[model samples]
Target: MASTSSGGTVELSGFFADLVRCETRLYNALNDRLRERHGIVTSQFEALRYLRDHPGSRVADLAAEFAIGIGATSKTIDRLEKQGWAARQPNPADRRSSLLALTDNGTQLVGAAEKTFTAEVAELIGGTLDSSSATAAAQALSKLRSVLERNQIGTPTG
Candidate 1:
């Protein structure tokens, strides 16, 4: 009883909904695996890895990069510091802000997390779709993500 235009809209909406559900499931599994193996959640592991990759990054920088509130960023840094994974150092360029640096333990944890995360993601992809389908899905999803970010959809602007 629906017009063709309406039918197409419904189909596209269903596709978007399915994509969100798939992403949620994948991320939940990833977080659970990382937490069980390393005692750190996905976000914390990402923060540690980010510090390792970009040493001397400020808390504000991390907050912006993660699209999280500054207070939440501070709490994440606090947890890393408590675990002896990261530490704050004096920022010569900005007296108002401190720089983040990874400790040896943090570096080690990042390395391990990278391996585990990579494997998990790969397994999810390989398990979910065949080679060609995975490639197609990756390309489609990546394009969608890029467009969303560019449009600032569901993202905070700095």
Candidate 2:
């Protein structure tokens, strides 16, 4: 492999590319399973889980946490509302924006989804690596994620 000017590691750029591909595949597989079991995509499942844990958060807050646009987050909240899983209540702190909340049904769905999601992820990853390797992978990925989050990393712009 040809080396880059930044470093002798020719695979540095490819490392990020491969990571993106891996993430895409993982999310696709997880989303498919989630949709099949609960009629909810991974994004919706994430939003629901967040709201379940952090009640009174707005769509904007969720969008920021999920690294998505406010408009998209609002749409997600709309779908959750339609499914009777989430509801928007008038915010006491801010009369302009309503806070999102998980209904009883939504809470139950998230609880069920969490069990299946965690199991599926473990099985999917562990099917490839042994217990120790899986743990190592988790630790490494968490570190990488922390750095990226701290740096506010996103899509490349030139």
Candidate 1, poorest ten consecutive residues by summed lDDT = 1-10
Backbone clash pairs for candidate 2 read none
Per-residue accuracy of model 2 over 1-158 as CA lDDT, tens digit each: 44565536557678779878988998999899998998888998999999988888998788768777778788899999999999999998989899999999999999999987998898788788898888877897999878887897862221
Give Cα-based local distance difference scores for all models: 0.87, 0.86
TM-score of each: 0.82, 0.85
Where in model 1 is the C-alpha error above 4 Å?
Answer: 1-10
Summarize candidate 1's per-residue lDDT along 1-158 as a digit string, tens digits: 22254326345676778988997998888899999898888899889988988988999889877777788899999999999999999999989899999999999998998899999998987877899898877897889878876876765543
Question: What local lDDT score does residue 8 receive in model 2, on the 0 to 100 scale?
Answer: 62
